[model samples]
Target: MPKITSLAEPTQLHERILVIDILRGFALLGILLVNFTGAEIARTGRLDDEVRRLLDFLISSKFYTTFSFLFGLGFALQLLRARQRESRIVPVYLRRMVALYLIGLFHAILIWNGDVLLYYAAMGFLLILFRSLPQKLLLAFVILSLAFEFWTSLPSSPSMKISGLLPSRYTPEMEQQKELDRTLDYEKSREAWQNHTLSTRSGTYVEAVKARFQVWITGRDFLWSYFWATAFAMFLLGLYAGKKGIFHDLVRRQRLLRWTMWTTLPFAFSLNLISAYGPYVLGRFYQQIPDWGFSLLYVLAGPLGSLFYVSALLLLFVKSERWMRRLSFLRWVGRMPLSIYLMQSIIGTMVYYGYGLGMYSRLSYLVGLLLTLAVFALQIPLSRWWLSRFQFGPFEWLWRSLTYGKPQPVLVRRVRPAEPT
Candidate 1:
């Protein structure tokens, strides 16, 4: 029988990959930056076009893509460990996914509109379904998903034609009109929110729930399938990485890492630059043209950039003790990602929403950026402190208990009785 290492033991560093945790923590910084900016924009009105362009290029989808990749990698690693321990992994994993879905549902309905946990939970089930496939087959699915996204970006794609039944929501002409209506509605909602008169502020819990559903329903795009497809593609790549043990020994694999870094970095940067800027610099008429090129860059360059980053970090971890010491803080945050992620949403809403500080309309991008940094800084020390006393974060403990249909350990140590007093 294989020996089982307890994650509850903080000193057993060999059981966990510090680099992966560091990357996850780094991803959180980017995620919060984008999310905070989005919230600030909704609250205070839009940002300047130039600033918007910059954010689109730099901060838009990159971090979330990294996060999704890590999730897939983690899944593969978990399955491997289960096999090592001769355990039934599938049922346990599915239960965990379900628990995540429930948590996500509550977060979406009660806390935030931009919640991705539900989406992650949903996609995680698909990951399980595809986990046993051959590596080549997995790569093929990734390619197919990217192709689908590219095809959908074409203006002549049949999406609109299929949506003809829903004229008000689907038709391009109607969509344009709806955009205006949405802006006006949002302005009014913001005013209400600022005054603490929104359903979420002054009304009953049911009213707030209803409001949340309404927000989700209206915001869901027909292109949602494409989004999921893209996310699944990243998951597949992450699985491949885990299977190959790409992150196993960075120092020994310097040649491989260097090749990937040099090969991917240049194209990723150039492609993303073109994708972000081509619409404006080329012409306004170019904006009306097919965006397949942009989508292509996003699918191809985005992952390449993500991989390049991973390579860079692995190298740093292997070569620089000083950097490792500094980045070790991220390990704490990354270890309890779910707890930190949910905490961000709760704190963010309270800081910005009407029922709390009502500072949503007062935020600027600069202020939002500062706030993001501050929250992450707080979370680092907070996560370390919590882990010091507990076997897991509160939510993680609950999730594991539910997943295994039994109570899991929570506290790090047990009380000892005095003998022969």
Candidate 2:
């Protein structure tokens, strides 16, 4: 097994960490595809389709699941390092999670109300128990958590109508119309409508933060269930990969990558159609069996799809370093994921919040997607440039400083390695 090591070591990050940045940067960029859905809903009251849902369908196939799987991969890396040091993983891991949760809490308010970091942090650290488990057992745990998510509080049937724990009471036609009015503001509500896209991205930070807390505390039925479990699973899986030195040994990693590729590639290719039709069959025809089947398939498919996504990246990491250079911007965002993720929420909320520009319900899916891309495009390059000058991203520096309960060196090679902690 590859011996564990310190993620907090004050050494300058070398080439080994580059692939992670590349993958994370790519994942971060892709996650925006789905984030557009939430951004739009925050501004307007519709899912104005024709293009947005199509984009969502394209993204939902693998993006979020890839993010989740990578979470497991990272956790595994942390645990393995702690073990090698003969250190207790919980204290360090929990500290990291606490900081993440705090960031998440703040992000939910001043940005997008749908921030997942706090939930990921709160539930993220709990994967410690599964750390030492064999792959089969670790996978089983993942399966159970997803099953629970699938079967839990779902509307049960088309007649039952409710989808999740807090399904909307709106009618089908009304819902359809609401979606149409999203981008086509000049429609029926044109007279009463006001477009507020420009300033909302950062203007309503205070109120947005306040509203987020209320939503977290008050939404009893909507309390997050599987977020922690999923994140934990991903973390432990990462740990396993790290122990095997998956990142270091390209050949061995490539073999595993191949296995995932064969399995998930077929599914990924066909996933868009499956996801789109699965829901339509459920809602339009009460095809409960297929609906339930598809839901189950989604959770499993998510991981499988995520695996393929990783495999594709591995190919690029090994075979296409030149192409990778063009995306160096993504690596910056990946390096400072904690900061960028929260910033995304902040930006989204300001754009849509009632106190700001209030463009939440107005942005069409297509427009929302464009906005997500624009924000990420701006973020990726800036993040990379910032890290080139500093040891950590701004939020990362604060998190490390607070985590160690002392000021951490923010400049490269500035802090002397203190005698073995």
Candidate number of the best TM-score: 1
Query: lDDT winner among the candidates?
Result: 1
Residue 262 deviation, candidate 2, in Å?
1.7
Q: How many residue pairs clash (N, CA or C atoms closer than 3 angstroms) in each of the candidate models, in the order given?
A: 0, 25
Candidate 2 lDDT over residue span 28-133, tens digit each: 7777666656645533334555465565455664565567666767776666556666777777777777877777666665555566776667657666666678
Candidate 1 clash figure, as a count: 0
Q: Assess the local accuracy of residue 133 in candidate 1 as a C-alpha lDDT between 0 and 100.
A: 84
Model 1 agreement with the true structure over 97-162: per-residue lDDT tens digits: 998888887888788756788889988998998878888888898889777766766666544233
Please state the error at residue 216 of candidate 2 in Å: 1.5
Local error of candidate 2 at residue 354 (angstroms):
2.7
* Model 1 regions lying over 4 Å from their true place: 5-14, 42-54, 160-207, 216-223, 275-290, 414-421
